[model samples]
Target: MIEVSKGIYWVGAIDWEIRDFHGYATPKGTTYNAYLIVDEKVALVDTVKEPFRDELLSRVGEIVDPAKIDYVIVNHLERDHFGSFAQVMDVAKNAKVYASGRGKKGIEEVYGERWDVTAVKTGDTLGLGKRTLRFVETPMLHWPDSMFTYVEPDRVLISSDAFGQHVAGSQRFDREADPHALMEDAKTYYANILMPFGTLIQGLLAKVPSLNLAPEIIAPDHGLIWTKPGTIIDAYGRWSKFEARDKVVIAYDTMWESTGKMAHLIARGAIDGGVEVKLFHLRKSPYSEAVTEIQDAKAFIIGSPTLNNGLFPTVGGFLYYLKGLKPKHKIATAFGSYGWMGGAVKEIVARLKEMELELAEPALDLRYPVTKQQEQECIEFGRKIAKQVKEAKQ
Candidate 1:
C-alpha cells in the first residue's frame, strides 16, 4: 500500500483488463480505490469491486491487520465501489459500517441484514483519535446515495465518483498522469456517467466553499487521485456550466454512400466557415467517444439514412444515449438521403429539439444519391451552422 498522506494509505485494486464499464467502453480500464487511515481507531474509506476484493485485502494487510479497522465508511453504494462490502465486513468484523441513509437502505436491500450498518448524513463527523472525517451528502451527483468524506489535517476529500477518470495504471496521482490523456478520460467519464447531474454538480460546487471544505487532494473511487484538487475542481466548474469550444461535430451513418458524402461535404463547409469539425461514422465510432465530442463542441450536425420509416439504428441509439447524457447549449442540424421515405432528417431534428440544442440551420433531406446541387447545399448547411456556432461563442 502507498501512503497518500502522513497516516493515510491507498489500499485499492487496479483492473488492467476491464475494457468496458457497464456499457461505456473503458479501453484504458479503471481502478476501484479505497483508502486506509490509521489513527487511534483506524477507518477504511470504501472498498473495491467483488473480483478485486483479494487485492484490496492484500494491500491493507501489508500495513495493518484487516481486523484492526475500526470504521468502514461507504461513500456510495454503487456495485463497483461496494460490491465487496460483504467481504470487508467479514474481515473487519469489529468495524462499524457507516453510510448515507439512502446508501444504508440500498446496501441492505442488495445484501440483506448480515452486518450492522449505521446511517449518516451531511455534517456528520466520526472522530478517530486526533483525526476526524466529516461526511457531505452529494446525492444525485451521479447516484442518490452518493456522498463525500473529508479528512481534516491531511486535507483529503474521498470523493465517491466525482473528479474521476477511467485510467488504470501505477500512477496514483494526477501529477503523474499525462495531462492530455487524463483530460480525455476525464471528459469521457463525465460525459457517460455524470453529464446528467450537471445541475447538481453546479450547486455542490457553489456550496463547497461555504461549507469550508477546500481539499488539497481529491481521492475518487476510480482513476488517479487528484493531488492538485483545484485543477479538477476548476474543470468540474467549467464542464458543469456546459461550456463549449468553437467546433462542430458531424455525426452520421449512411446506408450506401449518399449520406456519407453529405457528412464529408458538410464538414468541408464548416471548415471553410472557419470552425473546427469532427466527422464521425456512427457504425465505426463508439457512442462513448461521440459523447465526449458532444461534451465540448458547440454544434452538432447529424446525418442518417431512413430505415423502416425512422432513423438508422446506429444514429437512433446514439440520440437516445445523447439525450440521456443531456449535453446542453449546442446548436444542431440534420441531413440525410432516402429512397422511398425521408423521415431520418425530421426524426433527428425532433431528437435534437428534445435535447434543447438550438436549431442552427434548416434540415437538408435529399433523394437517393446526393446530386451536385444537394452536395453544394450540404456544404452551405455546414457553413451556416459554423457561423451560428461562432456567433454563439461571441
Candidate 2:
C-alpha cells in the first residue's frame, strides 16, 4: 500500500513465487496490479485480488476520503484486476466504474449490476477536476475488452497488461532490479501472454505513437511500472516488431531416450554455432512458459516422438492453441523420433506452417532408437538453425 510516486500508489501482489499468470497455466508467480491516483479528483486504476481489498481501502483512505474518489477505471475485466470492486463500492458508492463496451458484460457476469458501470468507447475522457483519464480500447489483446488509461497531468499511461510481464516481486520499477533478471522477466511475459496477439500489439504501438502523448509512466496491470517511459516503449517497439534474438527455442515432447538425445545435441549444435538456446521438455514445461521463452528467439524448433500414429497429444494441442494466435515472423523447423507410425514429423511441419512461420528446411525426422546416423542428423539440424540465426543477424 505504499505510494510509488507523489500521488501514485502500488496496490498489486508482490509474490516472489507467482511465475505463471492469466489462468494460462504459468510456472512463474504473477501480480494482480492496481494503482491509485490522487489528484483534483481521486481515481483508482483497477483493483487488487480479493484478499487485498482491505489493503486497497486503507491506501485510498490515506490519500483522501474514499467517497471523494470520482472514478474507478476498469482497465481489464479479468478478475485479477477487478476482484475488489465490491469492497471498493462500500467506500466510494458514488464513484463511477469506467470500462470498454466489451468489458461491461464481463464485469456484470462476474459482479452483476451494483453500481454505475459506464461502458465507454475508444478515446473517451473522464474529467475529474484537474485530472483527466482518456481511455483507449485495445481489443484482442488476449481479451475482448482490454483497454489503456492515460492520465493527462502526470503523463502516466495505465496500460492494463500490454507491456506487462509475469514477474513476481515488490519492486515497483525496473530500475531497481538486476538488468538481466528484468530482461528475462519481461521477455517471458511478452512471449507467453502477448505472442499470440503480435499483430494487435503492433497496431497499438503505432496508434499510441501517433497520439503524440509521451507517458512518463506506463503502469501496466502486471510487473514493474515503466517510470523511464521510453524504456518500455522501446521494448514494445522491438518485441511487437518481432525483433529477432540470437537464440532459438528447442521445445520438445520426448519419448524414450531417442528424441531426448536429439534435443540435447541439437541445442549443443546451436550453442557451438554461437547461438543461445532454451530447451523445454513439453511434458514438463507448460505451453505458457515455452511461449514466453520463445518470444524473443529468432528461430523455433519443435521435436516430438511419435505416438498413436500421430504427434503427441500435448504437442498437437499446443500447436492448435498457438495457431489460433497466429505467431509469425520467424524461421521454424521440426525434428522428432518415430517408429513404424512415423507421423510426428509431418504433423509438426504442418503445425509450424499453421502458425505461418517461415519454413527453414525439411524436418529432420528420426526413427526410434536413434541410429548413429540419425543422431548426427540432429546435430546438423542444430548447426543449420544456428547458421540461419547468425545469417539473420538476430
Candidate 3:
C-alpha cells in the first residue's frame, strides 16, 4: 500500500487488462481505488471490483489485518467501487458500513440488509481518531448514490468517481504521469461518463469552496490520485462549465465513399477557416473518443448514410449515446448521402434538436455518389460551421 498522507494509504487494485467499461473504451485499463486510513480507528474508503477482492485484502494486510478494519466507507454504490463489499464484509465482519441515504437504500436493495450500514448526509463526520472523515452528497455526479469522503487534518479528499480516469499504472499520483496524457485520459473519462452532469458538476465546484473542502490530495475511485489538487479542480471547473475551444469535430459513417468524402471536405474547409478540426469515421473510431473530441470542440458535424429508411446503425447508436451525454453550448449540424430516398439527414437533425444543440444551418443531404457541385457545397457547409465556432469563441 502506498501512503498518500501520514496515515492514509492507497490500497486499490490496478486493472491492466480491462479494455471496456460497460460501453466506454478503456484502452489503458483502470484502477478501482480504495483508500485505507489507519488512525486510532481504521477505515477502508471504497473497494475494488469483485474480481480484485484478493488484491484489496492483500493490500490491506500490508498495513493491518483486514479483520481489524473498524469502518467501511462507501462513497458510491456503483459496483466498480463496491463490488468487493461482500467479501470485505466477510473478513471485517464487525465493521459498520457508511454511505449516503440513497446509497444505504441501494446497498440494502442489493445486499438485503445483511450488514450493518449507516446513512450519512453532507456535513456528517466519522471520527477516526486524529483524522476525521466528512461526508458530502454529490448525487447524480454520474449516479444518485454518489458522494465524497474528505479526510480532515490530512486535507485529503477521497473523491468517489469525480476527477477519475480510466487508466492503469504502477504510479499512484498525478505527478508520476505525463501531465498532458493524464489530462487527456481524464477528459475522455469525463466526456463519456460525466458530460451530462455539467450543471451539477458546476454546482459542486462552487459548493466545495463554501464547504471549505480544500484538499492537498484528491484521491478518486479510479486512476491516479491528485497530489496537486488545483490542476484537476481547475480542469473540472472548465469542463463542468462546458468551456470549449475554437475547434470543430466531424464524425461520420459511410456505406460507400460518399459520406467519407464529405467528411474530409468539411474538415478541410474548417481547417482553412482557421479552426482545429478532428475527423472521425464512426465505424473506425470509438464513440467514447469521439465524444471526448466533441466535448472541447465549439461545434460538431455528423454525417450518416441512410440505412433501412433511417440513420445508419452506427450513426443512430452514436446519436443515442451522444444524446444521453447532453453536451451543451455548442453548434451542430448533420450531413449525409443517401440512395433512393433520404432520411438519415432528417433523423440526424431531429436528434441534434433533441439534444438542444444549436443548428448552424439546415441539414445537408446529397444524392447517391455526390456530384462535384455537392462536394463543394459540403466544403462550404464546413466553412460555415468553422465560422460559427470562431464567432462562438469570440
TM agreement with the true structure for every prediction: 0.98, 0.90, 0.98
Q: Is candidate 2 or candidate 3 better by TM-score?
A: 3
Please say which candidate is ahead in TM-score: 1 or 3: 3
Full-model lDDT, candidate 2: 0.79
Candidate 3 stretches greater than 4 Å from native: none
Report how far off residue 377 is in candidate 3 (Å): 1.4
Residues 324-388 of candidate 2 have per-residue lDDT tens digits of 65666788988888888699889999878767788889788877787777777778889889999
lDDT of 3 by residue, 5-39 (tens): 98899999999999999999999999999999999
Compose the digit string of candidate 1's lDDT tens values, residues 142-187: 7899999999878899999999998889999988888888888888
Ranking by TM-score: 3, 1, 2
Q: Which stretch of 10 consecutive residues in model 2 shows the poorest summed lDDT?
A: 18-27
The number of clashing residue pairs in each candidate reads 0, 8, 0
Better of 1 and 2 by TM-score: 1
Specify the highest-lDDT model's number.
Answer: 3
User: What is every candidate's alpha-carbon RMSD to the true fold?
Assistant: 1.1, 2.5, 1.0
